[model samples]
Target chain A: MSDKEEREISRIKEVESTNLARDDIRELVIETKKAVEKDNDLLANKIHRSFLDNNIKSFDIVGAIGAGKTALLEKIAEKLTAKFRMLVICGDITTRVDADRIEKYNAETIQINTGRECALNAYHIHQIIKNKDLQNYDVIFIENVGNLICPSEFVLGTDKRIIVVSITEGEWVVEKHPMLFKMSDIAVINKIDLKERLGTNVEKMIADAKNINPEIEVITTSAKTGENIDKLLELMGF
Target chain B: MKEELTKIEEIIANPNEIKISNIQELMEALFAKLKNRVDNYIGDYPTFIEPVYLEENVKIGDDVLLGPNVYIGANSEIPNYVEISNTIIFDNVKIGENFKLENCIVAKNSSFNFKNLNMKNSVLIGAANLKTELQNIGF
Candidate 1:
């Protein structure tokens, strides 16, 4: 073989050899949790203080996978972008899907790809806000990794915590993830467009959230059609 | 069979799922959701995996790797040296050369007109007249 061909062959081999058999994602979740102690939790407070000082409104959105977090954010950005200086710090385990989606509707996006952790904690925000000119944007939306349980435990230095659940997730979604509801300032029951055919109990879902956190405001929306989005923004103090 | 396919799709949601999702099927569903009854084929055959929907006015360039469940909407452009799989590209969008995209939904009127970009598992949308940068992974 020619020298160039030999070099290419060795390069391919080198790339293949680096593909290690890592632990499963589930195991990685548990391993990541071991580090989320009091000290780690306090890191978010630091970021929160900075946001407060800068007068930046931070909204942390947490939800189940496919619960329409990105869709909802898109709607919000579409409606409020002309009136607000908005940006989204979108988190995912591997890809920049949420960030990319939100960016479509006139909002700037910062894609945070969490390597193995199931959630975005204050530490992640602490690291992210370090470089941002915090004054450029008045409102920041922190779209947490699409997860119900793990994301609830992490305070992402946001002013308000919003948990989104879709009727597509089934009737028991709110009841099942009570802690997420408890931690949230508002609960969004999304995808009402599919509710009629799916026959999901929307009222029951609202009751579930109300029972868990009486202070939590509940809004039913179809992010697809922009239904009740204005009401959501109004409640969010847009 | 659909239920089995759906179970595979659930794997795509959970990062910790043991099995891989059937991406090709899901891409098909996404395209069918927004498909219009119009011809979109406007290019010579690159490599296309079975069952893709190219919406009206869609254009493909040479040496492209297209896969199943892929949908290119009307008035969109997929240039040469591009590899796409399990993706949904909406209307009025543009693509560039040496691009590799998978498991992504490119929203309407977006521009990915950049060279040598690699994006996977993304939902891309942006304003018109906006240019995209290429992010090359690995050394």
Candidate 2:
């Protein structure tokens, strides 16, 4: 017999030796198919129409862990709470730490524990707004789970999608996760206060992001030191 | 000191006069002493349900069932029809209606209001003020 046929026979034999059943494999396949078949554009359009109907501006913030996403949101919430009615939906694998921190700024907050999900999808946002009175807020911010890879694949239906990356994550972060930058409307290079100490070339990182999508708006800020936060708000048309 | 020594040569040769028969005997004695110390340390180790301690101000509503390895801290409120198993709840927690929790840790000052939700092997930290009508949600 052919070598490939022999290998396939051995693989089938190995599967038969294990306790894994055919029904388990079938269920996994069905679940995976459903997840892969989710339509992003349709959900995005629905979310956009919902926001337009309610006269609310929404933004989705995505980033890797320790990328200063929550810090940036906290800074923005603090600066804008006086003028705008804001609501924050913090998405995490577990814990409501970000939502609790944002609550100090006196904005209404909802914490969505995604459990094992890596990224927050449009369905999550839809569920949050399905029953609530959307007209109660002027702006909504959905802070996606701390991830750079999976969040790019799921569009959570927002007016603007911002990806935050820190200079401390090394120089190659933008280059490594180029898909996130390409899908994002704006890229925020955070933690500029440590730029000199870490010897990170911020200009090069910005150039890499621009290379992915030349039309993307790039803003640099240090959330800790409150640098260029007003400029970021201005870019968002606040 | 001479009586303490098993051999006169040991007392003469060793200045400290702490004589052992050999290195093997000394190791066995050391290990035996350590085992005894550890056993004594763990003699009063409490089981899951034995010697349960509940704070005076803790409020437990009707029809609440707590399984093994469950600890409810001070001022925590377990409302009606809630079941908890293998869970550790800290102070000031307020659990609302008809929720099932297993192998979970609920942090301090958190409040949850949901029905028919099952959470297992989850660690919920910080304050949560949630109100939802959950159905068949398992985590």
Candidate 3:
């Protein structure tokens, strides 16, 4: 067998080991065929090849508005670079604002301008990574638009979704937007340094979050003061 | 977090019916859905929701009184007592309390207050008071 064929076989085995059902494999094969027909052959290969890569760590950073997500993203980017080949797919309404903001990090950053589009769907993400070589990177970070509602509905085909919540926002944020909190794979409690100043009850906030999602992985950090950043990185598998 | 997201799995498994006869019809249906939500606004509301479309499983919060003739071109939720009137709310809104909104699309906890708000092609978060004067516009 050719190197590519062997790689494909190995990838499929890995996915099977992860408890993917027969129907899942069938759907993937069909999707791969459609992608090959419409997008290109290269993407078809990547989709199939993703099954083989043992270290394709993909995660997302989502949050409500003014939740200190941007600041926290920069700090994470700075730290994640030490151990992984990290890339950031920044989302915005009009232009590349977030992409421009994180330009100093020396990482691959692309601004997926949704224009009038509200959120990023799986097809859109497939289009974004189709032409790029993700083999060089160990991790991909998606800084989703600072909107809680839309991002919750769509899946970007990532391994995990990390929700960034700030102290200044509110304890009711998670309860109000249960979808975002519920969909998250990890919850980052940002801006802890201002917890006392903002009169936020930290334990209460965590408790409220936990009530919404019993299995949520929580990490508290201060993007401003750099508190518990190590814990955040550790959770991210960086 | 994975455990909490199980509800989404059910929604994704059993989605609301979608009928996009054509792209234009889809757009119109989206606008119609959004226009129905103008009664819930709470800040410097803008008119950015007039240009997009959404799928299903969207939710909003209270005190979202929509502004006059506002159009939201997507699927969304408007919770109880969120004051919004005569404004166009966009898709994917999770707004909260004491929001005086009008003439705009309130995005993702983006606030609005005051009267005659003109939010066009801009996203606002916790923004307040956007006064605009257009005689033709009414709640």
> Judged by TM-score relative to the true structure, which candidate is superior, 2 or 3?
2
Task: DockQ for every model, please.
Answer: 0.02, 0.01, 0.01
Tens digits of lDDT, candidate 3, A137-235: 777777787788888656665677899888778767766777887878788888888877888777877887788899888888898898988788787
> Would you estimate the TM-scores of all the predictions?
0.55, 0.58, 0.51
Comparing to the true complex, what docking class would candidate 3 get?
incorrect
lDDT of 1 by residue, A99-168 (tens): 6678889897766545446787776566457646888888999888888998867787788999999999
What's the C-alpha lDDT at position B48 in model 1?
45
Cα misplacement distance, residue A13 of candidate 2 (Å): 9.6
lDDT of 3 by residue, B1-139 (tens): 2231232223222223111113223323434454312122223222121122223554444323222234443455544444443334544544434444542334433334443333332223344444332112111
lDDT of 2 by residue, B5-98 (tens): 1232232234233223242243223223322110000111211111123444667655454433355667988776676654556678777777
Off-target runs (Cα >4 Å) in candidate 1 are A1-35, B1-139
**Candidate with more favorable, higher TM-score: 1 or 2:** 2
Cα deviation of B114, candidate 1, in Å? 41
Q: After superposition, how far is residue B45 of candidate 3 from its true place, in Å?
A: 18
iRMS of candidate 3, one decimal?
12.0
Candidate 1 chain A: minimum summed lDDT over ten consecutive residues — where? A17-26
Task: Enumerate residue pairs that collide in model 2.
Answer: none
